[model samples]
Target chain A: MEELKQAILNKGVVVSNGVLKVDTFLNHQIDPILIAQMGQEFVKRFNGKEITKILTIESSGIAPAFTTALELGIPFVFARKKKSLTLSSNLLSAKVHSFTKNETNEITVSKDFILEDDKILIIDDFLANGEAALGLASLVEQANATVVGIGIVIEKSFQPGREKLEQAGYQVESLARLASLENNTVRFLEEVATK
Target chain B: MEELKQAILNKGVVVSNGVLKVDTFLNHQIDPILIAQMGQEFVKRFNGKEITKILTIESSGIAPAFTTALELGIPFVFARKKKSLTLSSNLLSAKVHSFTKNETNEITVSKDFILEDDKILIIDDFLANGEAALGLASLVEQANATVVGIGIVIEKSFQPGREKLEQAGYQVESLARLASLENNTVRFLEEVATK
Candidate 1:
């Protein structure tokens, strides 16, 4: 988590409106080594939760989820952002609104992927509005699976996403929490010490 | 490779239009152990290439690419399927036509990610017509980088993707080469022996 905070300070850029972009190493251009480290951190944070499956969204969320799943030796099911020709089948779906894209789209997971007894660990790259993570949790409940906990790479503490998930009675843990981005200077909620 | 073939033969379902759906293990619901095995196989097939980076498309391609990158100790950059609100400037863009979705979309990569001296290895989940591979190659060229090779998990050898890349003078390697999918039965060109 300290490494993550340092990486955000050194490489992250906020374009406008408190939107922190760590795509340099987090989303678009991935550093799998750092991702593996974050996976270790997530594993330590949610220790002994007995995570059976990892649930993530398509595109950005796959990186950390894949690394964590590999470290945990578990399979991951990524919900499709859109029901394409290949994914037109029985699915558990929920609508999610993206504040960045300003659009609402239905995210779906195949019905065969998640069974009733599976324990799901939901991970995401960014947890801004919590729509994507909640959408994944929606599918988790639809499948009658137990929610272990939600692991987030970066969370905007100024936003209401953590509050929303907490109100919904889900355990949420983020590696890096950004307190503010006032004047393009990113500040961390908790001061992270270097190792 | 034998494990991949067995996974295909046992769990892969050949849907209509000769589309072999291995979403059960390869893409949608990903098996991390099998993916790790395939990554080691990639490390073997692409031996001594001195690949500096791995390039792949978004969503489905990230799983195998993640494992392969982690195995090879190289970073990977996934080309964004669409230009998002966060990724708005300084991008190397190329238009690609998707046969599955029947539409053309511009795939963009951040200009800051790739360098002129970077040697890239492009990997993908499936190769039918090679649009995604070619699109990634376009981005590699735009960065003034050298492409070491193209690696595919399943190449529909009946299609023209391999031929097209070979004609383009690219070293294209595939783990499992499907001969055909006649009568809803998937057959591999190279009959992989189980390990």
Candidate 2:
């Protein structure tokens, strides 16, 4: 987590008031070594939980979820952003509002992937508005699966995402929590918490 | 490779003629254990290549690329299907035609991640039309990076992808090379000499 914070500090760019860009390492261009470590950490965080499957959303959540799935030795199921011809017609759908895109889109997962009596672990790169995570949780519920935990690489604490998820009775754990992004400088709550 | 073949024969779905869907394990719902083994196989296949990075496209390609990158302890850069707010303005772009989607979309990788001197190993889930592979290759070329090898989970031999890529002089390795998929039955080519 410290390494991730340092990487964000060194390379992350604040594009606007709320947008923190860590594309140099986090999402677009992935640091696989760090991602693998993050996956291990997630495994540690949810050590006792029965994580039968990892649920993520494309296209950014794929990397971290992939690594996490490998670490946990579980199957990774990601909700496709678009419905391809290869996908089946029976799917569980949820509406996700993207803060960056400034629009809501329908996210879906095939019914065959997630089954009842399965324990799911949801992973993602960032949790901003919590729309995507909530949407994925919606799909897990549709499958009659239990969401064991929610693991995030980076979380925006100033946003209401964490509170919203907590209110929904989901245990959320984020490696890096951004406390504030003011005047083009990103600050971490963990940094202040440690001091 | 035998394990991969067995996984396909046991779990892969045979769609109509020349179409085999291994989405249950390869793409839609990914088996991370098998993917980890495949990653080791990729490292062995491209053993001597100076691979500085693992290159792939978004969505399905991210999983295998993540595994290979973890195996080699390298970074992975994925080309996005569309530009997002987080994406940088300076990018290497290429047009990719998806056979399943029946549409052509432009994929882009930000110039900041890939360097001119980088030696990239490309990885993907399937090699059907090879448009996605070629698109990633184009991004690497635009970055002035060398594509050391192309690792595919499955290759449809009936498709012209391998021929086209080999003509372009790329060292390609597929886990299972299907000789043909006739009447919804998948068959692999006979064991041949390895390059």
Candidate 3:
């Protein structure tokens, strides 16, 4: 978590009205070593839980989720943002609103992938409004699967995302929680433990 | 390779007018063990190649590419299907047509990721028409980077994708090559080598 905070502090940029960009290593281009560590941390946090499958959204969450699932030796299923021509038949879906893109897209999962009685952990890059996490939970619910916990790489604690999920009775854990992005600087909610 | 061919034969279904659905293990719900094996194989084939980076398209390409990059101890950059609000001003862009989705989308990559002297290896889940690989190669060209090779998990040899990439003079390697799927049954181009 400290390293993640450092990465954000050293490389993250604030632009276009408080938007934090860490794509250089977190999103567009990935540092597998750092990502693998993040995955290990997630597994460490959920140490005793029997997670059958790891779940995430397409595009961004796939890498971290894949790494986490790899560490757990479990399979991962990512909800597709759009229904492709090759994907068909029965599907469990939910509408997700992306504040950045300023648009809402119907996210779906093939019903065949998620099975009832499977314990799933949801992972993502950032939790802004918690809409994406909630959407993923909906898909798991449709499958009659249990939502064990939600793991996030970065959480904008000032936003309503964390509170929203907690209100929905879901346990959420994030590696880096930003207390505020005020004055063009990142503030962590808690002190980062330095080695 | 034999395991990959076996996976396709066991879990793959030809649906929606000859579309092979390996979502159970390959695309939607990924079998991490199998994917990691595929990644290791990529490293095995491209041994001694000085690959600075692994390039892939978003969504499907991220998993295999990440694993390949992990095996090679290098970073990977995935081309975004569209421009995000957080993406930068200067970018390398290309127009890509998705036969599966029946649409064209402009994929962009941050110019900061790929370097001119970098030797990039493009990796993807499937090679059918080869349009995605070509588009990714175009991005590398814009960066003045060299594409050392193309790694594909599965190649539909009956299609023009493998031919197109080979014609373009790029070394392409695939774990499984389907000679034909014309009869709703997969026929391997060559007998998978059993270790």
Model 2, C-alpha of B66: deviation from truth (Å): 1.0
Model 1 per-residue lDDT at B28: 92
lDDT of 3 by residue, A54-140 (tens): 999998899899999999999999999988767766899999999978899999999887899899999999999999999999999
DockQ of 1: 0.83
TM-score of each: 0.96, 0.95, 0.96
What is the per-residue lDDT of model 2 for residues B40-148, given as tens digits with 9 covering 90 to 100? Answer: 9999999988899998887888888888988898888888898776664898899999887789999998888789999999999889888988998999998888989
Q: Is candidate 2 or candidate 3 better by lDDT?
A: 3
By DockQ rank, best first, the candidates go 3, 1, 2
Residue range B1-195, candidate 1, lDDT tens digits = 889888998898888646888888987999988998888888899998889989999888888888899999888999988888777899999998988679898999998888899999999989989998999999999989999999999999999999999998899989999988877777788663222
Residue-level lDDT of model 3, residues B86-118, one tens digit each, is 775889999989887789989899999989999
User: Which of the two candidates, 2 or 3, achieves a greater DockQ against the reference?
Assistant: 3
What TM-scores does chain A show, candidate by candidate in order? 0.96, 0.96, 0.96
Shift of residue A171 alpha carbon in model 2, Å: 0.7
DockQ of 2: 0.79
Q: What's the TM for chain B in candidate 3?
A: 0.95
